[model samples]
Target: MLLTEEAMKTAIILKMLSALEYDVFDPSEVIPEFTADVGIKKGEKVDYAIRVGGRISILIECKAPNAPLDLKHASQLYRYFSVTDAKFAVLTNGYDWEFYTDLDEPNRMDRRPFLTFNLTDIDTTSASELSRFRKSVYDVGAILSTARRLKYISALKTRLKEEFDNPSDEFVAFFGRQIYDGMFTANVRQEFAPLVKRSVSEVIRDRVNARLKSALLQNTTEAPEEDIDLEEKSEIETTEDEWDGFRIAVAIAARVIDPSRVVIRDQRSYCGVLVDNNNRRPLLRMYFNSPTTRYLGLFDGEVEEKVAVKAPVDLYRYADRICATAEKYKSAT
Candidate 1:
């Protein structure tokens, strides 16, 4: 099932813990509604609390999808951190996780995390490093060290980007020396200015592409299937409201059919079961990733189903039936 932002965050965090070899205890055992008077008490709650030996060891707060970790929100977590014995704190919204530790002062967390990890997108090495946070292998000191490294790395990258955006005289001179070594002349500074600009633009483009690729990879991993055996599987090319109709349709089929029978090709677009060859039924006539779900069932010709979903994540909510629906779609075709 497509997971809601909150659910997704919880799932990813749990997955991280599992990867670290931590004994993934029940969420209910650790995460409980805030009942104590700990300052702000207007229905606010921490997303999770990690426990060790039946005692709270860490406090975690979660933000909604795409929400920024502004000062106000971080302060709330800070307050909670001070009150709890859990020296470590975490703030996450599925994609980015920021860890906090009170190394500088009592109840005051460092400006930087003890460690930071991004779930949906990360390099293999970064992923392996992040895996150390798993329940079993968790070492407070080790995490702190890693966090320090990440902080410096982050600062270095930020400064590099800043320089790339607004080149400095020193930066220009250094590159000039490397690229035009031995031929360096007074004119070399002016000559390499365009090169610097070009390099900056290329770096920006590469970063954008990396983000796009990560998103694509995440989508593919979420959508697990090769092809569905349904004839006349129609595919729609359009946008919708909250959820992607075609994806929901494909998921429905995926839930029901044998894993081999259902196949989701091309990630978001062009999905359906291949019942036979000469005929392919397209589930979606006009597809979209938003709320208004659309699907076409080709029994003989075409049948349309417009499903309204509350959230984009709900597309995968019906994972079981979604798979079943794929088989049904295949059989119908």
Candidate 2:
């Protein structure tokens, strides 16, 4: 069954809050749509108002899938935040929820989130951070610190990306000093500069690949085991095993890199996994009943397509084979 983007976002949010629900508070009390009027002389509905001790503690505004989350979209929420007793305001389109509080200054919300994670993107850390948002375990100080760190971390990443894309000579020299302690001559700097740039790219690519892998694994594990064929439970199980094989491909990628960089596509008749965040660019494709695994090229921007692999399970065995590959790469270098 195809999951709509809205459904996907809802599922992701629920998953993030899973641990919090059991350990933090009474999940039933965390109502989805609790209304409030700040006596603004007109009626406007907010998506949610988290109530505790018979008082509204938080307000939320949800948007539809893929909607741009900007300040304009947050106008109503901002207004509600000021007029009501709700100390926190949230804006989300399901996939990305940005949490705000009066951290920098009272009556003014901070631009960054206290916690942010996509439903399609979560790690153990993301899950743990999300747990703090549960009404039962609301700790203002803890959330504030987490938000501050995330805000700065995001800013630092943005700066780094910008610098990488437009590296000034001074920036290069500053990094050069840190790496070699002013030992390198101009010739050496020139030679080593490309290496530094390449390493930076590899780091980003590996991270992206790792994230995709993690998402694929989560998707595979959560997928229900439904019996599609009437006569053969065994056949259905076999099909499931093929999915397990697809998962194994992701598991292999996870061990190799950031785990988020691997993604899978399973469209009934065809199932495949991509090694990087290449947008349906399959690193390998598996024909359910076919006996081969395809070797799609690692791209060079353009000239994109896929090649075939003859052994699906064998490539799946790459999970088991990764350590040796890593060792070989290390030894070669």
Candidate 3:
């Protein structure tokens, strides 16, 4: 098939929808384009739509690969959204997709997308978010709640990254007032800006070192005592979520290998799901370092697949990959 926008939708987007277990439809066989009761003068046909429980749940608007899927591009989608009872609208360019919901006002689509997914790079976290759009587990209320949470979190993280890279005057002043007791002089503000940046860098470095030390210590016994004593020895604090992630990994691996061969090794930087008590033979690495984000690292030879996640169940997103990985290391399994 030619590499046109419509072809890309069939080649990539349609296949993805099928995999997600959505009952997808082309407008021709289904009822034609959805027209808004307001907005546009003439009714228009949507590129495609998906049904859950025999009702239109999502409207998908497809664009060419090079086209940007933004508010301007989604103007028609917003019009269609305003007229329908469908809770979600999707804009895609075969490579990237943006998901929108009417969170700010009823029947009015929010300008900010709740979640975005890339067809070329599907992370476990994004997969989990997409799962909510499935026919078997479509819950309007639950998805809306999660969308609201992620939308704000994404916005906050964007602002934080900007401040972290180049601290704004307001950003410096807000933090300076909390730390300094005396008058907030310009010199003090200037001094503390660098201090704040240095402190953040140090904290990140220390955390990385702590995890590396923990992993190395657990993997070997010949390391010098002085090296181990460089940092204070503290008990590993494993969260319920991490343990749940371990169990999910084990269960997925058990499909191809023996469950008994899988073991959970908790460390400072990441939790290792090892096979046959061998650190060299790692199945998955759980890096739930930040409260806001999680990462599952899986390797295939020289390539490492890092999947972002939000919960334990999200680990299942890579179940097939996990099983295939375990099978490759079948000697240890």
Candidate 4:
């Protein structure tokens, strides 16, 4: 763990720079404790500075692992940005790294980070963006050109996530006005808000299910002979709700095991999720045969416990138990 700022600088920051083909030992390429003249302050120091062709191109500020990389924490980097010949500034706490550039104005650091990501939980998009900073292919012109677009895209994604969790009045009204012919009154707005939220959730869930189905189909070319025979004998039809439940179960179990390993097997009685398509290593079961009520069969104990679920989303409530079951199966292997 990078407890101190110095520890974070040497352990995490330096290693990242090294991976980017920046020579950590070379003072011209990676300068530590780079001094910047901040107006009256003669020797104000930035944590690190990366130079390209003997000119400082990137300035980095390091903090302890637990420290927040907010604007207030980036005061030194903000100050040094104007004085030094650097286009980009990075503020990081070993785990979370925030990349800032002068998008709003020239030579002035923007209030918001153009790019931000956590080292531990980096997505594909974030990884792509981070690759641009590599010393071998570092281009100031190309990076700045895409930085503005990436900034807005990141902001829009954040806004969408917020709206997904809790739809704002304007966001709800925007859709309500389009759908309803009548005047979008206060009562109408209140009525449509929950509906909009539900609709958005359902759309996202459907997309997730589609992707999961595609992955499952790719993994399994043909149905197992046993399953084929069973389906032939009994008219076993899997419902949309069962698929939703299975997707939710796979998502929950994914914390402990791979999603592809959690395969779904449809039987007349219930839809079973098994580890590596093994019946003996059952993860969970979805008993959605009844229209009035549904149940999630958990196998944390000796006997399978059927827990009542109102909807597929309710499966998230038992994530701990589901993950525990997956962990047990994973450890057994």
Candidate 5:
């Protein structure tokens, strides 16, 4: 059974920290309550405080496992973390851990956490980062430096993901004015939004494919499990329309998923857009196999139903179904 209360949630976090080799202590020794000012409340208690070199280095507050992790409700963390010499503060609910630092100003905590990790879903990179907080390797300066680097990187990835999914007027107009003739107008901005998104996705995928070819000792993008003997079989030629149709399917599905991670594979029978370059993670299979009557092979569980498409835009007519199929693959990743 899952813990749904604060007390058990704290136990889970302490166990994780212990496994990570952190010397944990109860609130009595750390003293969660503090006298900040004359009028304000005192004797407030934070859950656990991890110390290093006889000083607080990491302050943690735990909530129920099922509770939403938000900084607005963690105002106490923001306050307790202020006067302490600790460089890091954490808000967690056993499963979801949010790490915060004082990046904007000295002593005052930032409104948002620099990093968040799910106990069940943490990546190796995150695990390595969390390792820095261990009792054996605790370093305040090093941890703060890592926090600063990760804070900016996390922010950048978020901004780029947002733009990749839906290009803003400014983002579209930036590319529009360079290639387009005459004055840049609202009409032009409206015209290039979808075009910009498609063009960017195409460029990103092409670059990734090129890098994959270079990085994998010249191995094909097709993973070995697909058992595709592209070596004996000649490379399939992809026409302009097929490429555009792939981009069209990409754009249509981008609304419901992360379009940037979608990989395009030009195969002998069709052009496939997959999740994370896995053949099994199929989003849509374009059989522009017949130029006159193109068919879109959409997956429904084990069954793949082919729908005839006249043009790239025609695929938008099946956007709901297309996105729904992509969702399954995305969820798997």
Candidate 6:
């Protein structure tokens, strides 16, 4: 693990620069311990300066693995930014990397980073964004153009996650006003806060399950001759409600087993969820045939217990039971 600033530089940052096609050994491309005069401070030193076309383009500030890459730690980079020719500044602590640009003002780094990503949890989109800073394909004009949008999008995503977890009074009131017809009192706000949070969580889980189901369907091949005969014998019609309940069950079971292992098998009477698509290893069943009420069939070993549910969201109330059933099946295997 990277412990010190020098270890972080040599172990992580240098390798990242090399991956971006910057020759670490070339002093002209990757300058280490770069020093320059800044205002009244004589010979202020920045950690590293990346040069392109014989000019400094990116200034990097590194901190120890235990240190937080806050504005205070980037004091040198902030001071050297105005004096140097670099348009971008990076603050990193071996794991979390924050990229800042002068989007708010000319020749000054913004207080907030326009782009931020973690080395440990990098995704394809973050990888593509990071590629714009590569030595071979560096485009200052293109990056600057999208820098503002990326900054705001990142901020919005962070705020949304925050609101999802603990929603503010304004957010709860916004939804409460639409559905609720009574006076919007403080009592009502308190009552609706948990409801709003739970609803948001359910909606997000439902969307994720839908995406997984779509991808699974796309990759599914034709069934074998024996399964085809079994499919022909059962005249099954899976409803939207059944699919929703199956998705909810899958979401709950995900806590115990891989979601791909949970499969939906619709029969004439009910919709069954099984482990590894095997009928003998039943997880749960959904009975949505009744127009007035719906029921969830949960399993305890070989015995099935049918519980009446109002909607798919009600299945969340039995999440512990569903997870226990999945755990039992998993342990049996």
TM-score: which is higher, 1 or 6? Answer: 6
Model 5 CA deviation exceeding 4 Å by range: 1-3, 6-12, 24-43, 119-125, 211-333
lDDT of candidate 6 at residue 232, scale 0 to 100: 60
Per-residue lDDT for 66-117 in model 3, tens only?
5777678667877778777678988888667788898899988889888875
Each prediction's RMSD over C-alphas, in Å, is 10.7, 14.9, 11.2, 13.1, 15.2, 16.8
**lDDT, model 2:** 0.55
lDDT of 1 by residue, 153-175 (tens): 86687789788878777888888
Candidate 5 residue-wise lDDT, 166-186, digit = tens: 999988888899999889999
Q: Rate the local accuracy (lDDT) of all candidates.
A: 0.54, 0.55, 0.71, 0.80, 0.70, 0.79
Q: Report the poorest 10 consecutive residues by lDDT, candidate 5.
A: 31-40
Candidate 3 stretches greater than 4 Å from native:
1-4, 23-43, 117-124, 208-333
lDDT of 6 by residue, 121-209 (tens): 44434555776786766889988988999999989989999999999999999999999998999999999999999999999999999
Stretches off by above 4 angstroms in model 2 are 1-35, 39-41, 161-170, 176-195, 202-333
Candidate number of the best TM-score = 6
Candidate order by TM-score, highest to lowest? 6, 4, 3, 5, 1, 2
CA lDDT for candidate 1: 0.54
Q: How do all models score by TM-score?
A: 0.50, 0.50, 0.59, 0.64, 0.57, 0.66
Give me the candidate number with maximum lDDT: 4
* Candidate 5 vs candidate 6, lDDT winner: 6
- Please identify model 1 stretches exceeding 4 Å from their true place: 1-28, 35-44, 162-170, 173-191, 197-333
lDDT of 1 at 309: 42
For model 2, residues 201-259, the per-residue Cα lDDT tens digits are 88889999998898768656443333335454333333554454554444344433444
Candidate 4 residues 44-158, lDDT tens each? 6888999997789999988778687777856878888898789999988877888999999999999888888766545546656776787767899999999999898889999
Looking at model 6, residue 264 earns an lDDT score of 80
Query: Where is model 2 poorest over a 10-residue stretch in terms of lDDT?
Result: 324-333
